[model samples]
Target: MPAGQWSSAQGASTSTSDLSGRYGNGRPRGQALIVILAVLAGVSGVAWLIWVTGFHGRPLAQSGLTAYEIVDDHRATATLTVTRRNSGVVANCLLRAYAEDHTTVGELNFTLDGSDPKRVDLTKSVRTEREATSVELVGCTADGQPRPR
Candidate 1:
C-alpha cells in the first residue's frame, strides 16, 4: 500500500488512517463528510459506551425489581440493588430510559437508599424506537448514598 492508500477487500482505498485527528480532509468533500460523520459517530459511540460502561451488562438485583416494558408510554424500566460490602449503603433506585442517539427521552433517575427501602421505579421509558435505549442512574457518594440530582 502507498502512503495515501488503505488496504481493502476490493483494492486500495483512501488512507483514512492517514488522518491525524478524528476526521480527515484528503477525500472529496462528500466522501470526507461521510467519513467524518461515520468516524465521529463511531468515536462518540465508543466514548458513550465507555462513559456508560459502569452499568452495561449489569444485572438487576432480585431485591427490588425486574426489567419491564409498558406500551402505554413505549418505555421500559427496571431496578437493580447495589450493595457494597465495604460501605453498606442502600438506596431506592430508579433509572430513566434513553434512546439510541444518546437522547434522554423517558423516565427519571432511580433513588437508592438503605435507610429508606430496596425498591426501584423505572418509568417514562422509550422502546427501541428511534434511539438506542439507555439508563441514567444517580451517582452516590463514598457513603453509598445517592447524591441529589
Candidate 2:
C-alpha cells in the first residue's frame, strides 16, 4: 500500500528476509547464471575467431590464370601463376578448359617441383575433345597436403 514497497499475493509487505528466503545470500537469482553464460559465450567466440583466422584462413597454395588461348579444335593452352607458402615443397595443379556452352572440354594435371620458385608462371597445353572457349585453374595443393576446396 506504500510507494517503493512490494506486496505479496496475500497482501503481506515483502521484506529483505523474504528476498533472502527466495534467493540465497540475500542477492537476486539468475544474476550469477547470466554472468557465467556471458563469459562462456565470449570465450567460445574468441576461440572460434582464433581457429578461423590462424588455422583455416589462407590456403597452402594458390593459383591464378594469367592467360588462356583456344589454339584450335582439340587443343587449348593455359598460363598459370602459382604461389606456394613453402617453395621447397612440390605442388600439383589442375587446369580445365570449358567450351562456349560452359561444358568442361579438357583438363590438365601439372606438377611444380621443389626446384621451382615460390611464385612462377607456367604455360601448359591441354588436349580437348572439341574447341574450348576458355581455361581456368581448378585448384592447387601441396604435396602431402589437402586439396583446395
Candidate 3:
C-alpha cells in the first residue's frame, strides 16, 4: 500500500517493484539484461510468427503429384493433388516427362477448380524423341502460369 514498498500474500517484503533493489541500486545490470532479453525474445517470437503466417493469410495455392506411371514412350498418367488455401483462386500445374537422360521430353498444363481437396487423375501425352523414364509435377501457380522447372 506504500509507494516503492509492498508485501506479498506469503508475507514477503520488497522495497521496490524490482527485486534488484536489494542490491542497493534502482535495478541491477543483470536485471536489465534479463528484461532486455525477455523483451527481445517476445518481440522476435511475434515477428517470426507473423513472417511464417504472412503468406498463409493471403490467397495462395500449392499442389503435388501423388502418383505417376509411364504408359508408354509417349504418354504417362499422374495423379495431381492441389490445395487451394485461399478462396476463389484457381490453380494450374505443369506436368513434365523426362527421358532416361533426365531431359524434358514432354509436358502438359492442367487446371483445377480451386476447391477443397482438389485432385484429378490426368493423362499427359508428350511426343518424345526417346523413351520417357519418369514424370514429375513441376509446380503450381494461382495465376495459371504453367512453367515447369
Q: Poorest 10 consecutive residues of model 2 by lDDT?
A: 140-149
- Candidate 3 off by > 4 Å: 1-38, 50-59, 113-121, 143-149
What is the alpha-carbon lDDT for the whole of candidate 3? Answer: 0.69
Q: Model 2, 60-123: lDDT tens per residue? A: 6888888888999999988878988777878888989999999999999888888889988888
Residue-pair clash count for candidate 2: 0
Q: Write the per-residue lDDT of candidate 3 for residues 1-149, one digit (tens) a residue.
A: 76777557535655574556446766669999999999999999999999867845543566667788887766777776666656566776687889888889888877666454544444455455557888888877776433332
- Screening candidate 3 with a backbone cut-off below 3 angstroms (N, C-alpha, C), the clashing residue pairs are none
Task: Choose the strongest candidate by lDDT.
Answer: 2
lDDT of each: 0.48, 0.84, 0.69
Worst lDDT 10-window in candidate 1: 140-149
TM per model? 0.30, 0.76, 0.55
Instruction: Compose the digit string of candidate 1's lDDT tens values, residues 1-149.
Output: 56876657555554666553557455668987898899999999998998667543332332323444444445555444454323234433445566666766665444344554333333334343443355554432323233422
